[model samples]
Target: MTPRQRRVAIVLGIVAALAAATALVIDALRSNMVFYYSPSQVAAQQAPGGRAFRVGGLVAPGSVRRDGLQVRFVVTDTVQMLPVRYEGLLPDLFREGKGVVAQGRLAADGVFVAQEVLAKHDENYMPPEAADALQRAGKEQP
Candidate 1:
């Protein structure tokens, strides 16, 4: 091929490679993306059935049950409640009637199987999503 044609082909090849790389990056991000939902949303079945996602709300008062390393609790937005089961050490800040965000997938029996649990770090700090959820449920942040 002529010199000009050779340069054009090289440029086209580079463009194709870049496009492929971008596509791959986007796909990876999409697959690993985890969305945050409130207890109300979960009650309405807005969360994905088998995919992992985040649920943020207040831990229901007197709803925590511990069985060895397995702990069960209910998260509520004051409008709806979702049961969560976690099998690990809970954060020191985790307590009843406090804000929490759990990452996990929903089981077939309608329980959230949490892989990770995060509690509020301070007396006045709540996650934005949890605060919004509480407000939407007509409850002020505690």
Candidate 2:
């Protein structure tokens, strides 16, 4: 083949490889994507029906109950509430009326079975996803 033809062929091969790589990356991301939703959004049936996702809001006051290592709490956006069950030790910053984000899937009983529970690290820093959710619910952290 002529030098010009060889150069064009090499360019086309590189483009094809890049396109394949991009498609693989996008597919990986799509499968791993976990969306965040507020209590109100979950209540309105906007959360993922069967897949794992994240729910964020304030831990409702007087709604935390513990049974041995298992803890049950209600996450509220001031307008709606979502019941969450976590069977593990909670973070030190986790408390009633504090911003929290729970990553898990919803059970058939309408309770969130949290695989992981995350609490704000400090008094002023709420998770960005939780903060945005709270803001949409007409509330903000102190």
Candidate 3:
């Protein structure tokens, strides 16, 4: 082959390799990525069953229950509530009637089996997801 032809072939091979690598990366991410939702969003039943995801909302008042490291709470957007279960050391800000986001799966029973729980770090701050859910629910800051 001519030198020019050889160079063109090498470039095409490199391009093909890059395309394959990109596709693989995208596929892997698609499988692993878990989306965030609110209690209302969870109530909509849009999440893929048996796959992990995140849900954020206010910890419903009087919904916090603890059994040592295992905790259960209900997250709410005023109009809807999602039960969440987590077994781990919770953040210091975690409490009843606060903002929380849990990463886990929506079980067949319609509750969330959380693997990790996150709390808002500041008193004046709420998670954006929780804020959005509250806004959608027409909840006013009190």
Best by TM-score: 1
Candidate 1 residue pairs that clash? none
Estimated TM-score for each candidate: 0.94, 0.82, 0.88
RMSD of each: 1.2, 2.6, 1.8
Candidate 2 matches the true fold with a TM-score of 0.82
Clashing pairs in 3: none
Query: Which lDDT tens digits does candidate 3 get at residues 1-142?
Result: 9999999999999999999999999999999997888888778887777789999888989988999999889998788999998889999999888888899998888879999899989888888877887887899643
Specify the poorest-scoring 10-residue window by lDDT in model 1: 133-142
Candidate 1 structure lDDT: 0.96
Give the residue spans of candidate 3 off by over 4 A.
1-5
Candidate 3 clashes: the total is 0
- Model 2 ranges off by over 4 Å: 1-22
Model 3's alpha-carbon lDDT is 0.87
Candidate 2, 142: how far from true, in Å? Answer: 2.7
**CA lDDT, every model vs. true structure:** 0.96, 0.92, 0.87
When 1 and 2 are scored with lDDT, the better candidate is 1
